[model samples]
Target: MPAFGRTMLTHWHLDPQVAYLNHGTVGATPTRVLAVQQAFRDDMERAPARFLLRELTGTFPAPWRSESRLREAARSVAGFVGARAEDLVFVTNVTTGINAVLQSSQLGSGDEMLITDLAYGAVTMAVHAVAQRTGARVRTVSIPFPPSSSGAVVSAIRDALTDRTRLAVIDHVTAMTALVLPVAEIAEVCHARGVPVLVDGAHAPGSVDLDITDLDVDWYAANLHKWALTPRSCGFLWARPDRQADLHHPVVSWGRDKGFLAEFEQHATHDPTCALSAPAAVALLREWGWPQVRDYIHNLAWEAGRRLTARWDTRLSTPEEMIGAMVTVPLPEAAGSTDADAAALRLALLEEDRVEVQLHASAGRLWVRVSAQIYNDITDIDRLANAVRQRLVVSSVESR
Candidate 1:
């Protein structure tokens, strides 16, 4: 309906001087969404006790309200993700939601928690912590990098599940690799082995069309701050109706015995504006038309991968179907192949070229993960391409 690319940059507060290709890392919120969050904060400060105790959670009755502000917001978000409000609750981020599920799991000495190597580092650490606390063990399944097909990913997880696997954690869209895993198919395989699935959908909400109900997983954790245009520190967890009874919030607070929604709603006092302002973010998505927005971003990301790989003389191993609004492309061998090299190259891109992107070393080569958003265009990709090439030339000269 409206123009995308630099013309759409007016809606966000991102610096014009920097070519930002890192939207998937920590999302950039739009100016309008921030203003809406500020309004909620202003209302909360006016009557702190009434807002927090009486009206925010609706656990206790308020004279003028039929539902809590939090539940109302949850309902809005649930609809967006094709979930029921009663089955979903807000958490600070994806890591928090996954931790809550991990802590509540019924595991014994021989039990195992299965996760893939592609999981976010924080999630991997959280699973390890749970295993340490309980007598359980963590088993990592390594999905082949630059996987040939989605079936290969599903098969890897299927082969990894065992009788001891009490839970299987998978990613809807991976972090470092930027591959969109076949979660539904993977869930089917895990379910056959009687293993419950928990999906870390951190990069999924805004990047692709999502329906939590269709995923067939026991639990789904995702962020609204990243692709959904919400302010920072807003994420949600969705549980099947049958799974809710056994789940507990990570923080034990006033609503301990109350239901799943109540347990998460009263997880100690913290800023609630990020969650409260989520409805505004959903509204913006509707205004833009989700399909149009998704397509524009996905196409741009694919184009970026194509152009960058061709320019760098490297290959894009992941197929287009497995990519969403972000794609990971390998850098030339000249970029170096260690974590330190990746870090130094990233810093150079930012400091020298004002082009910020996510870089990591994987499969014996340096790779750049480019995130395409509504405010980005081919010019940004060209900037990144030119900058990296310049670095390669400089490296070649110095080495001789």
Candidate 2:
């Protein structure tokens, strides 16, 4: 196994001056993977027409190529997630893929789409937009923050499903709360209720051991950029064979009726280097050993949760098993509890302490979501703890 921690920062181009504990927000790509993406871009520049049309999608006959470049990259990514290449296609991000599924669905008046209160905020907006367009109702299932157990999560979703529920969207790992949900069990419950399941696995690609085939869901949308070490703006959508027929890309293009792959892969024209270079990211994962990487980060996140809660005199109500590479720790009560307060503290941490992390106000308190990566170590955690502690001391003095 390779040595992980501050030393591992050499593999990426992250600034040494700042401690970045926000990998789950927008991932940092390794220098090696960036080089690979640059090479693809260089090749495209050399022959724009041939590379984008002939090589990318194989729109024209190219004697030198047997398959399109996009398909080859898709195959590599499919293998990493334990899904067939045909079932997976790349998108700009998880939001784009989820929007495709939502737009394709045939919802109408009296229909309901089930989502949780913990779903990503942007996704919640998209669901509401669809609801407004089709006269469908959006039902939000409230899963308790800091859930007691995995069974509790499953039960919440199961109880929320009703005959009117046309589709159920679940998060494999929630964003703000940093909880790794029991998606398989939740999917099973939705299936029993005759509801199609769409999972937003934005943080699951490299954070957790993922196998799309193993989860019984109609659609799975995730980001390779966040945890998978891919370049920014790369994500994928996997659909069951039966579900593919009704799926459509969010943007209508020439590949409208060809097939699912054609619809998504040939959607207008944009930068394809990110998706084409996905294999390089997967290669790096294999080089480092996936199990070793996951173990180190997960352990780091678990320890951070324990240490921070102890320092703040708070409790980590969420079980360790529900944590992946990111853990949300409650701030000291001295820290103000409001959206504005959360933003101010987050900015203060970045500007004054040189630390970057995700923070949010939830359930009338402020919580920090710390993302543990190979480049982070205990010292980074300690830095954040001290920074917050100092703020609390200052606040106490000011109150007098």
Where is model 1 poorest over a 10-residue stretch in terms of lDDT?
52-61
lDDT for each candidate structure: 0.93, 0.94
TM-score of 2: 0.99
lDDT of 2 by residue, 326-392 (tens): 9998998779899999999999999999999999888888999999999999999999999999899
What C-alpha lDDT does candidate 1 achieve relative to the native structure? Answer: 0.93
User: Model 1, range 1-400, lDDT digits (tens) per residue?
Assistant: 6788988889999999999999999899989899999999999999988888888987567989988999999999999999999999999999999999999999989999999999999999999999998989999999878899999999999998889999999999999999999999999999999999999999999899999999999999999999999999999999999999888998899878688888899769889999999999999988988999999999999999999999999998788999999999999998999999999999999998999999999878899999999999999999999999988998899999
Q: Compute the lDDT of residue 199 as modeled in candidate 2.
A: 97
Highest-lDDT candidate = 2
Candidate 1 stretches greater than 4 Å from native? none
